[model samples]
Target: MKEYIVTKHAIQRAVERLGQTEQHAPHHLKQLMQTAFYQGETPGPNGFIRKFYDHFKTKTRLVVIGEKIITVYKFPEAVPIPFADEVAQVIKRKFAKSERDFKRKERALSIEIAEFNVELAQHRLSYAKAKSPKVRESLSDKISELETKVGRIQFELDEAIKAFNAIKEGAAKYL
Candidate 1:
């Protein structure tokens, strides 16, 4: 997390540049206050504009300068917050609404995996039924094909799991 800070060095530099505290106060102090007093969405919330967000904050700190509340503005610092987890299911569910593109894909992949498993079972049964060299060879080939398809599906599943975990961890760190 980063913090907004105006150090002693910065004040000293400002004083040196302006040559007089009174002169600096009249010219720049008001502008700085106006900038800081703004109540609106910052860059932190990406969906700030989309939703009905009504969070308001007031930042007022007293400074002992000529015995007055000289409103000051400093650049803000930012830190990220985790909005949600279970992002994998969220993405898959989003596919339901926007199904024109990927609905067929989702169905096809599931169907293919189911068919692959059924074919593997059927081939094993055939090998048991016909105890011959050619039958065994054919069953072996079919089993190999099913295994390949399952391997591909396994790789895709691993990737999805990794992506989900990475997103969770990365969002935990920062946005």
Candidate 2:
């Protein structure tokens, strides 16, 4: 038993060192695989894979930028736990990209709304400055257009806020 334990430790160190340049993150998850296998349960690749995700998730990053750019767990893989961990890393990267996309969309939405409001204000000023009835009427139509755009963006922002809240709540489970 002692020799087995020693061998496992040695293998873990060796593997970690071997992967150093490729991945700075330590393989703390390997410990769980070692303990479970040492007990003779003979966990197969799939079982060890589960432990790997759970371990890697808790020790490292599990929650990736899920579907909507919020942090969520990576997908499960069929390989060993280490494989799952690698997948989790990929998920994390995907999450980052998704998060950036979401932020970009949000910022664009905000800017659009701001621009609409500014247009509305400008139209109102134009309506006031109009010297002729036809020009005032035209300004009124433009103001109405701006108002409609503002309403549409407001609805979209509200929906996004709801989605963000749900994602935030769901993220609490992983943390």
Candidate 3:
């Protein structure tokens, strides 16, 4: 329902680029401008609003400033880049492998840490029940060693998780 002032330049461009006759250019341009507005416009450089309309097998790009139609021209078709699909597939595979490796390492480290915790618990129980100070000290040493091993494995798991997250973030840019 908004009014638009169709400029002579816009009519001229439609006549030249869209093959419309000079007599009919204004009407045709007005119709295309309406269609473009209905479809919505994207903000262009230098305060221009750019819109596109496909009519009778022709794709037209309309440029406007405020409510004035500035220019009308054909929208160019995109050309496909060579090997783009192959490159995408390769990148996807690399990220998948990295994710799987991280998960596998995490699972293994988690299992090892769990086992060490069970051993530590058993050593603590034995230390509590033992009468001799020597036996209790020995059990205490074993518990400390197991705890150290568990800490080291947990650190490795954390590092693997960090590395996997970095790879995931890097892969997002490409895919």
Candidate 4:
């Protein structure tokens, strides 16, 4: 793994440009620098590298020389992108919609499981109160069937939740 060192001057510059306090600047700057070093694209020549970061709604640029962060400053102007922002917005909306759909499905499955449990409980009560053996046997079968339904629905809910979590993890990188 490549390690990039964050200098005191870079931290101070990030604190000033990004409106972060001195106390929290070092850690935050280090994290941002590390992320930039790994994830950010270098826009300049091989010897010169610039990393653009958005911090506190302010676009900033970090100057890195080899393994040392030389300084950080507010970006003077917007980086030109004709349709990249629009495409990103569309992709974000799609992710949001998928997340909402998964949540809705999970809720629906949970409600269904609860309703099955309630029906099972009612059947159990009926079984206990019945006097005839025929009715008791029938109720016992019904309760077993309801329990199976509940178990199946519960498994589905668990799978849906796992899928939702996976989507969230995948979306975090972009959003």
Candidates in order: C-alpha RMSD to true structure: 14.5, 15.5, 5.9, 10.0
TM per model? 0.38, 0.45, 0.55, 0.51
Candidate 3 lDDT tens digits, 55-163: 4345787776777878888867678879989999999999999888888888888999999999889999999899999998899899889989989988888888888
Question: Runs in model 3 with CA error above 4 Å?
Answer: 1-81
User: How far off is residue 71 in model 1, in Å?
Assistant: 26
Instruction: Residues 1-175, candidate 1: write the lDDT tens digits.
Output: 2123333543544455434374454434333333343343233243323111111233322122222222233324455435544564565565444444344555666777787888889888887888789889988888888899888986765665565566556544532
Which residue ranges in model 2 land beyond 4 Å of their true spot?
A: 1-95
Model 1 residue 31 CA deviation (Å) reads 42
lDDT of each: 0.50, 0.52, 0.82, 0.77
lDDT of 2 by residue, 74-173 (tens): 2345565656667766666655665676678789999999988888888898799889999998888888888988999989977876776665565444
lDDT of 4 at 15: 76
Residue 2's lDDT in candidate 1: 18
